[model samples]
Target: MIEPDSSGDRPSGSAPETTGRFIVVFAETEADPPAFLRSAAGLSNVADSRDFGHGPVDPATAGDADATVFASLGVAVVTADPQQAGALRMSSDQSNIESISPELVHHALSQGTLSPPSALFQDTEHFTWGLQATGAATSPRTGKGIRLAVLDTGFDSSHSDFAGRQVTVESFIPGEDPQDGHGHGTHCIGTSCGPRSSREGPGYGVASEADIYAGKVLSNSGSGSDGGIIAGIEWALVNGCAVISMSLGADIAQVHPPYTAIGRRVLDQGSLIIAAAGNNADRRQNDFGFVGAPANSPFILAVGALDEQLDLAYFSARTLPVRGGQVDIAGPGYRVHSSWLMPDRYNTISGTSMATPHVAGIAALWAEATGYRGRELWSVLVQESSRLQAPSVDVGSGLAMAPQE
Candidate 1:
């Protein structure tokens, strides 16, 4: 495990945080990945996903294994020395190995600063501003049969409002349980899958009836590496989650290779992965930051933040000129209200992080309403979105909306 670093700052041209380990992506035609690894790189202490039967891979139990292969994703997180990494790269030309890249460290993309807009939609006795802005307030579809996964800093399993909901929890962070220590995950859950009828506050969640799959990919300190994140993604895929929401990313302008492959594979498997465009922008100062890391992957849908007036959030990233760095959609994110830890009960924060779940939840509603998965779901979202005065580079197709019928 690396040291706790809460300050999410990586200078423009600086190298990103990496684990020194490498991720290996195998081609679909690879007959025996483990055997190939053994022959090519002489790696033996490998744990295969098939060993777990129907359950998810336990990172703790497989600690001793040098390489843990996720069968569903055709990916492996391998720990190797310089010699082994070089050998694997050389073998990729003749072997089924497609790409080898260093594993990156990712952090939760929550905004550090808060600035609520003065005018437009506000929370009422019935619904939060997010719901009103996205038309989730009147959407008949409740994501009834959809399985939505929130891969973040765990979740508050005991959160009161979600008592009777069908919530399945898992922790990819080795030492931690599924319970959320950082409130980001819980707040996101409240927005994406919290109950429709609340005991205290307005209905903050969008897909109130969607089954919740809380995967603790990030640790309690709100940081994690690519290995754990990949494990969580594999778990969600194995369990047939149609929509996966990631509110975390690394502050790298270049498109991360692993996420690019992962996003394409996830979409191919009939799932959609929605991620937050990093809160690195300060538009007030004309410092429009570009989308970063996983969100910059071409296959994954990147989301930007919008205030109540449907204006772009100051901290929301502007699109990069690169292929997949553009914001594909927008969501209510400024000073959004949602569930928090116990005693506090609720909290309102702002970020592209908050915007992600809004799109994810609304994706669930659309998934339930149209029976669409993967790319089809992505198309419907862009097609059904409400166009705004904001440029396409910033807001993409505009604010994503829930299926109203």
Candidate 2:
């Protein structure tokens, strides 16, 4: 669901008729508990009731059967203009019922993250990376010279685990890095560029020795859109990141312009932009019937997801990814462990969100080894990636083999 401003207006212009957003609505009877109504009704403040596209089921059937209800409603749903869409819009007769974006939702990501023990992943086996694909029993490159920028909600710089790691952080959204309040950014950073030292806690991160920048584009709830993402990319470039890892996705545009321009600049300036293929593989990333936008751009290394045991993941998108000569890669997404915000708990998060960082880390290691920059590192990355044996249009360059092996 999308949120409207306080006047119940959209962020910019009127919500486009093809606004590409949706909300669920339903009504409750007196017999139903008021608490449930509070939760469901709360959606009104952010999204506004008039914009709710479908449904008016009983509170009893609405809570657990929302999906079934939506399916029954079918494709004949009606969305509203943001200006007219504020809060609940009940009729005087109690015949009409609707829901809107929850007032408390504040952001997009549905769940808060759990924290990984800095000590638990102290060894290779329990860690996120033990060196990839280079054929060593362990990884050799520490990623000391690499600079990785994480574009997500925000980061928790105050954690002892991140003591000296943060260089700079800018919020495209209205928030602060110290407010890694959402936890997505924290986990993302831990994936690509967390420190390698044992004293830094045991959340096994990939480029343990690389410097980092936090580019907060998404809100604490993981909420974001194409605009913020583009802004984050520009910010990352200005900050001088060697690798900008985006563990997020956006709706693909039917039209294209300048998407390649920013990234090409990053690439030309010797930086790599690694992005998620998108979790919407099931929903369809766009009208082209495949991967999300920006990922479609030529300069990025788009990554798909895989399960921890190296199997193709359920969430990974299927696409014949090729931009110029660049063939994207895949990596572990599900059951792949990493740090969360809640202390002592490791998050088994999945999605291209989790997978993109693995590629960023490998590229960092490669940059460390070859002193390669710009398209040079990007070329090595594509060439060195594990090629698919029975590669499908869905699975790209097979899986990203453990970079250091």
In terms of lDDT, the best-performing candidate is 1
What digit string (tens of lDDT, one per residue) describes model 1 on residues 35-86?
A: 8777788888989988999898998967788888888899888887667776
- lDDT (C-alpha, whole model) for all candidates: 0.90, 0.60
Off by over 4 Å in 2: 1-125, 129-137, 175-178, 196-203, 253-256, 283-289, 320-327, 342-345, 390-392, 401-405
Q: Could you tell me every candidate's TM-score relative to the true structure?
A: 0.71, 0.61
Q: Which ten residues in a row have the lowest lDDT in candidate 2?
A: 68-77
Backbone steric clashes in candidate 2, count: 27
Model 2 lDDT on a 0 to 1 scale: 0.60
Could you tell me how far off, in angstroms, the CA of residue 53 lies in candidate 1 after the best superposition?
83
- RMSD (Cα, Å) for all candidates, in order, is 25.3, 24.9
Give the Cα error of residue 330 in candidate 1, in Å. 0.2
lDDT (10s digit) by residue, model 2, range 1-405? 233432232454644323323343444432332223344333222321223345454444333322222333321122334333433333212533434442222346668565432322113543443223222115677678777888887777665566666457778885444356687887777777765444433445777778878888888877877677788887777776788898876656321346577668888888888888776655333422346666767777778775544555566665634452122777657655566675643455677888887778777888888888778987887677665432445446655543453
What is the Cα-based TM-score of model 2?
A: 0.61
C-alpha lDDT (0 to 100) for residue 88 of candidate 1: 84
Kindly report which residue pairs in candidate 1 clash with one another.
Answer: none
